[model samples]
Target: MMLIKRIAVALALWFTAGMTPLKAETTLLFNVFVPRSNNFHEVTAQWAEEVKAATNGEVTIQFTAGNMAPPPEQLEAVKSGVFDIAFIANIFLKNKAPLLQATMLPWLVDKSENASIALWRVYKKHIEPKAPFPDAHLLTLFHWEGGQLASITDTKINDIKELKSRKMWALPGPPADLLKTLGMSPVATPAVQVGEMVSRKIVSGYMGIAPEIARDFKAGPYTKTITWFPRSVTSTSFSVFMNQEKWNTLSDKNKEAIMSVSGEHFAAMAGAASNKEMQAALDEMKKNGVEIVPANPDFYKKMQAAAQPQFDAMRKEGERLGVNVDAMLEDFIKESESIK
Candidate 1:
């Protein structure tokens, strides 16, 4: 009788377990090429926390191990589903976001905030319609703006003419183009090569976002002068993308939870985060007695005129990309001025 009772109890327990639903969960992998301390990594970590909370722990974002994936491999990793998500520095994928390059036109706006906002507006209206990324879902777009010229010499970069014939390490695409147009010898080198190239005196300096001084290249000590341009040269754009297959597998609720932290909403957050880094860098530059040059209103106006060729070049490219480049530029200028 006792054996019969045990068998009956086991059967009931097994049946109940089979009837009950298992809790649903999803996990995704994120790959970052830069150091763990990069600003975007911080934002991504924050985003992971918030998204998990929003999803009530149903979704977990796992970052790739090790602090090293080449940036060039990032987008492909996600596309191949080796990683679920990644940050694609758009410059590396030339003509991949062709219309998006309009934001790189030199002397676009004085503030990073205005430039990003204007670009986001233009992107949604014109560029995004191009289906820029067919292989992935673009979660959000951000750019490092207010690019400053950091040189080895202890002199302010007060005149555009001063850069003429000087070797400048430049990212490919619009920056290299702008540097060439500005009459600087633009050397296309990887970010990791910047400091070595500088040490060899192959390039006098580089124009990049300020955090790179302390972070990427440890360039601050090597830099004797830092010049903050007004109506700044183009910002380098980056995209946070998810593998479309993985994105498609997500429920609407899960997708909402993730995307809630991106797009225009996230653009504002990214721009603010970048400004904090720039301010910290500026403070250090002051402490180190680096020559700091702020844009002269008179000089900026003259530089804007000099930037006309860059504008024209990007406009022609935009038209070829199937965007109404002239109208888009007008709208972007209007949006930027409003923000200013």
Candidate 2:
């Protein structure tokens, strides 16, 4: 009878052990450019939700948005592990990532979706694990869509010549560089300050997509015309980077699951969201009486001609770094044309 009791007790312990749940939890802090309801917000949230559900609640994300911290500081903050994830512009991080500047060169890409996909393909295939972003794992890299010109001070700027020497609120980084090339004096300012700057007559115009102007900046009182310059397309390549330590700690299965939905796949979703927002914002702008101007054929040709030298110079820089920039750019353009 003792022997029987011993066996029964052992079986009961085994059953209890088998029935116990194994809990795996990971927490991520994500940051973005605007509030929770914005286009970018929707894209990031969707990605987080999909990952969480796929992992059966094993992963959780906490998000913070707005220019709460300066844009340029985001990558370094993530590299230092202050935040597990951040959405940062390729241009803002240009100091750390010079090659990335090649992708952002003026008029190099025709569509945000194409540029985003091509850039992600190139980064995954070549960059990322090499140096600058070695401390973090790239989640996604996408570009914003359809940047246009809008003004609060002056009503109209008919041609590129008219844009020359106009005081405009620059979006900083490459846009500043692009505007300067067009002979416009860029008044360096943060996106949040655009409304106040316009109201105070500090800037004659603002350069950005309509959604940013209408939704984020609430651009109305200080503005009049929305010029459809489409000058130097303002698609920002953004990434949701995971701290390297955290990424390494994850199970291979979990990592694969996360990656399955990230990188190029994530970029597509983000690109689509940005495009939708741009369209919606333009529609909203029209309703609000903002004038939309299109670039004349001559203006388009001139802008393209001006940007070619910049592109060639970047290719030379790539060769010095031992990267085939011509191949990269060719691949980018080829794939861009193939995408749609």
Candidate 3:
């Protein structure tokens, strides 16, 4: 009887061992709104690869680009578990994440990598608790170096005055405000439509990245001039968001794996890619005889002056949102400058 009992137990243990492991593999769904060549899309792919390698394939990410969801709808989709992961551009969530606007106040950081680090630090410290990512877990924050004005018109945007007479395309939030303050009529146009709008005479020019402009507007055909500016002019803020429920279910080992490649590191990676893409587009513009015009210091000073009130308003809004705007601004800039 003893020999039979021992043999039965050994058999059961051996069979169960082969049938099940302790951890189930997980593959997360990553949603992107742009094409593979797009900077953000490229970064997302890298992030997924890093996470998978770090986890030894315990976890993986399946990317579904092609506008799986629009920016405005991303917040709710993430919270509702429509996507396990998504990137939310801050511009689309003004009412939802009002406090985050502080980091985006133009002219804060000079480089995309700098802005990316600053945003990650600030969000973790100040905005995460009060900000509305609505049922999502904040992963990382990043931004491009800065955006500039590009025109298809015969006249160049050498100064604010040139912008005044032009019907300029603007996105929501600070970009629209900056142009309006500088005396340009801000026409709210979807990025996909910028090329068509310019061709049809709906807008004289636009304030965005050269890469984005070339992608949508085929700048070589329509753009005769490109304008560059500093942080005081414009930048974009984007955050990596995951459904809270999904995040909670991740094992500690897997959590660490995902986060291992996130934060400031991810920010720098994405920002650098964006900067490279911008430079490439500018080079193409030059080859096509599109005049690449650097905004003179005179123009910069004028824009800084014109942009002051907008900054003030952003600070006031920050205060109303219960954050100490002045102090946050100083800290944000300090963190940005402190990063090499």
- Candidate with best TM-score: 3
What TM-score does structure 2 among the candidates reach? 0.83
Better of 1 and 3 by lDDT: 3
Q: Which digits, one per residue and each the tens of the lDDT, describe model 3 over residues 157-274?
A: 8876677878888765677777777666687766666677778888888775445545545545788887766553567778788888888998998898889898888988988887
Model 2 error, position 260 (Å)? 0.5
Whole-model Cα lDDT of every candidate shown, in order = 0.72, 0.71, 0.75
Count clashing pairs, candidate 1.
0
Instruction: Please provide, for model 1 over 1-340, each residue's C-alpha lDDT reduced to its tens digit, 9 standing for 90 to 100.
Output: 9999999999999999889676589898888787767687787888888778888888889898864357777777888878888887777666566666666667665555665667777878987786466578988876675565667765556677666646677655555666666666688765666777777788777765454443457666677876677555667767788999988988999889887767766666676677677777777767877777787676667656766776777677776777788798789789878973
In terms of TM-score, which candidate is stronger, 1 or 3? Answer: 3
Off by over 4 Å in 2: 1-23, 31-33, 62-70, 126-132, 152-155, 182-184, 208-211, 220-223, 229-232
Candidate 2 lDDT over 1-340, as tens digits, reads 9999999999999998889577879988886756567777777788989889777788888886445466777777777877778878776765566677777665656567777888888776556544345457778877777456666654476567766647877676556666777666788676677777777777777775445554567665455776654434455667668878888989898888888888888888888777777777767767877766776778767766655666777777777667777777677767777897
The model with the greatest lDDT is 3
Candidate 2, after superposition: displacement of residue 267 in Å?
0.9
Off by over 4 Å in 1: 1-20, 67-69, 165-167, 203-205, 208-211, 333-340
TM-score for each prediction? 0.85, 0.83, 0.87
Candidate 3: stretches off by over 4 Å: 1-22, 129-133
